[model samples]
Target: MGEWSPDTELDGYEQLVFLLPEEPTYALEPENSLVATLVRHDAPRYPSALLYLHGWKDYFFQTHLADEIDGPGYDFYALDLAATAARCGLSSSPATSRT
Candidate 1:
């Protein structure tokens, strides 16, 4: 995964880009160099971590969920899939509506 940076699309969220390994089935995929973006709320109080993922072709961007999860002492992190992030002008991401 790449370095963490302030999210340009989602307020109160941090973003990180992961340069995935070259896909062998590149022809099946849209992009050659595939990448995944991780959006997170920087409030971790425990050793455990929680990884949140959204469904395919869906709209789910709940900032409050992160806060609620963080309240339970979990290091909250959510995946923005490549395509979703891209759609939101996150440069390279994928998701439905986050509004």
Candidate 2:
């Protein structure tokens, strides 16, 4: 993990990627390896934080949900779990295939 960098998927935000060790996922995950993303505002304004996590075969792209929810004194963030492995060639298996 390193400094937050601009997220290619969405504007007005930054992201950090963590390369996790390979593990058994059965059908839901890829055996080649895994990755996770932590996305946050380039400059967080609130002390209170809110984190959103996307499910399998999904990545965080919606920013309005964060804008709307962060109004309640919360700094919004999102976690994308192994959602980009296949796209980036980190995993050889299909990211969306359950079987």
Leading candidate by lDDT? 2
lDDT (tens digit, per residue) of candidate 2 on 1-99: 556778757788887766655544546554544656777877788878988876355567678888887778788888876644444443223322212
All candidates' TM-scores?
0.65, 0.69
Model 1 over residues 1-99: C-alpha lDDT tens digits?
Answer: 457776655777777767545633234455634456677875346888888986355333687888888887788888756455434434332322232
Off by over 4 Å in 1: 24-31, 58-60, 83-99
Worst 10 residues of 2 by lDDT: 90-99
Backbone clash pairs for candidate 2 read none
**Whole-model alpha-carbon lDDT for candidate 2:** 0.65
What are the root-mean-square deviations of the candidates from the true structure over C-alphas?
A: 4.9, 5.8
lDDT of 1: 0.59
